[model samples]
Target: MGERIKLPNDPHSPEFWVAVRQAQGIVGPVATDTISALIDAYEAAWPGLPRKLADSTKEKYRQSLRVVREAWGNLQAESLRPSHVQALIETLGATKPGTANNVLDALRAMCRWACGPREFLSRDPTQGVTHFEQGEGHKPWTPEQLAFASDNLTGMLRRAYVLGRYTGQRISDLVRLGWTDIDDGGFNLRQKKTGARPWCPIFSELEVEMSTWEKRPGPFLLQETGKPFTTNGLWKKLDKVREDHPQLAGAVWHGLRANAVIRLRQDGYTSMQISDAVGMSIPMVERYSRYADRKAGGQAILLSMKERKQDKTVKR
Candidate 1:
């Protein structure tokens, strides 16, 4: 009988109160106030996300929301059917399984927030969604590949490449590194991805490398304007490095991070020690450590008391 309720231009906008008032007259059965309240709850829950999440992670959430809107733009929260969610996930899986699973996770959280404890929708749609399985493949750098890449990379690209391989910091944190972060001992900074602050003890070789460079005003890895290198710019440099050294084609920038992890574990660092050194989660360190152990045929050296007794007996 009255004016029809319209969704706000920004669904997250605070102007939903006006829309809610209008919706009550048109839709008498289901109150718009309830929907607005659910939306508010969802928005409130969004801000308390852990600092460990990187900027890229927030971007992924935005992308997931776009995916959701594209698939089911017309569907109301209360009217959303399980089949709709399944179809949306299927669409996402066709192009990107990993992204799709991430989207499903975000959407599931949103749906839970909207529907409360009960199944307000037809059913729980994202229950059976699965993430893509990454293959177990490590193309470790051969001597020739390493030589080619090192020889071709000149200037800052070379330095960044070498440092990444040696230190194993992710490109995100490595590029933003400044002289202030470095010292006579090592470097210390909060890892951008995990927000974990770590202190790395620099080796003599790295020390020598640092001494060669003058103290710059900005990040160690900088653009022509002396600004810190963005992730995209770093990737572009990586692409150039790969092109220059064709043998290292399959070597991703992140592979250096993996290389560092492997080397640290090989050097007899414990999982916890490596995690602290690399500014990674303990679980991630454990995963890499397990992989390293597998690669080295589980060749761990243990100083057992039984071995000590045997040695003493042999001496006697």
Candidate 2:
């Protein structure tokens, strides 16, 4: 019989491995593969996101995922059920419905990814959760508020405020506006969300404002550094104005778009015309024009129906 191979003093020592290498090869122990946590789903999902999401969208998704982890750290993905998700959204809805809906939407996307080729989880808990009403967070800015901004805002912010109020375009779209976008026709917008080419009339108001400023080399909305601002950067810039003028509370940059639609409606424009001008769907135009409709109808009623002594003129 062949002699047994010589062995090291300590069987588990590095010398033992060395000896094994001299004779028969031995593979080292492998670290165990990690089990995925709730957060892992997000990490995995991001890479596989089919469309290239905007930075704002990516941040929002990351934020929502962080929220889930904070609420339920290392929670088994499969343990999340429809009832659990619904209760979570209900709690968030009490404070910020828009935010709650955003979180829910992000989670739903995660769930779909999990159910897809990746299979991070078995089912989506968010499916049955009813979303809170959006648009309740803020309303259109009033004329007084616009006047306040005009008086208070200075430099780039003043121009930004004017563009938002008049163009009916999102800050994302407006900040990217350049000399190239301007034509003899008007302010041409390739909307970010809809990808629709919309034209805003060169109102005498915006025209006068633009005439005062020298055009920068690139985007019209240039910062002190001669660089175009990201949407968030523009938002932060405008938000600073709020610190000085509290009257602008609830009258954020986005609300300016709504205000434009509302003002157009108030000027006796039909919903269809408003829709065409603003590049909005018919449904959206109707929704925005409701106040205008009621206001006009009430005034018409006052002329026809005699004002009863009991009735005071209803303010719209």
List runs of model 2 lying over 4 Å from the truth. Answer: 1-48, 70-79, 116-123, 148-154, 183-204, 229-250, 267-290, 306-316
For residues 153-234, what per-residue lDDT tens digits would candidate 1 score against the true structure? 7777877877787777888888888788875567898888667788876766666777888786768887777677887898
Enumerate clash totals for all models, in the order shown.
0, 0
Candidates in order, TM-scores: namely 0.68, 0.66
RMSD of 2: 11.5
Per-residue CA lDDT of model 2 for 1-316, tens digit only, reads 5557886664323355455445554456411111124344355445546654565677887787777767765466677788878888889899988879888887887677667665556666778787787563336788789788888788888878888888778888888877677868577777776566777776788888888978656777877887788888888887777776788876777788788888888887887777767777777767766666788899988866666533555532
The window of 10 residues in a row where model 1 has the poorest summed lDDT is 27-36
Local accuracy by lDDT, each model? 0.68, 0.72
Highest TM-score model number = 1
Model 2 has an lDDT value of 0.72
Where does candidate 1 stray beyond 4 Å?
A: 1-53, 71-95, 108-130, 137-143, 289-291, 298-316
Q: After superposition, how far is residue 11 of candidate 1 from its true place, in Å?
A: 9.5
Clashing residue pairs found in predicted model 1: none
